[model samples]
Target: MDIVTANQLKTKGISVIESKLADKKEIIISVRGKEKYVVMAIEQYNYLRECELDAALNETRADYQNNKFITESVEDHIKRITK
Candidate 1:
């Protein structure tokens, strides 16, 4: 991880941030003495989102395998939910 101050960002412009983000990693942006924000490449953010979805799907599969889920037809689900 790398850190940059709000002042530096203001003075140096986004080009500096763009350079740092070239590796597709996160950079910490601090305002005052506190670390407040993160900067990352779009690819990194998308990859993380896909990874989160994959994790959720894996958990759902595990639950189904362990019989920890409910079963119903799509019409039954719609009727139950609509009620």
Candidate 2:
């Protein structure tokens, strides 16, 4: 993680963004000398997000494969709920 002042970021915004994206690095933008926002490549963010979702899906599939899933039918579930 790299930290950049708001002024510096505003002055060299495009170059900073390009460098971060090329290196797949994250930059923390600060305002009033306090950390405010993060900047990252869109592709990197999307790839990481997709990886997380894929991991969750794989875990769910593993649980289901291991018979750790609910086996209630819709009608039975509705009847039990109504009762």
Candidate 3:
């Protein structure tokens, strides 16, 4: 992880992005001495996003397998709620 000030990020946006892509690194952007944002390569971002989705999906599947799922479609569930 690399840290960059917000002003530096604004001025050198392209280089920062290129560096992260070339090195598979992440940049933490700071604003007023506090961490504000993360800069990562698109591929890395996508990979992490997919991993989060997979983890959520696995949790959902496990819950369903344990008979913890609600057996209702959206429409039926809504109708039941409105009744």
Index of the highest-lDDT prediction: 1
Alpha carbon deviation, residue 57, candidate 1 (Å): 0.4
lDDT of 1 by residue, 1-83 (tens): 88888998999999879888877499999999799999888889999999999999999999999999868999999998899
- The better-scoring model by TM-score among 2 and 3 is 3
The C-alpha RMSD in Å for every predicted model, in order, reads: 3.0, 3.7, 2.6
Pairs in clash, predicted candidate 2: none
Q: Compared with the true structure, what per-residue lDDT tens digits does model 3 show for residues 11-80?
A: 9877866775576558788899999988887787899999999999999999989998778899999999
For each candidate, the alpha-carbon lDDT, in order, equals 0.91, 0.84, 0.83
Candidate 1 residue-wise lDDT at 81: 88
Per-prediction TM-score, please? Answer: 0.79, 0.65, 0.76
C-alpha lDDT of residue 23 in model 3: 66
Q: Write down the worst ten-residue block by lDDT for model 2.
A: 16-25
Ranking by TM-score: 1, 3, 2
Candidate 2 or 3, higher lDDT? 2
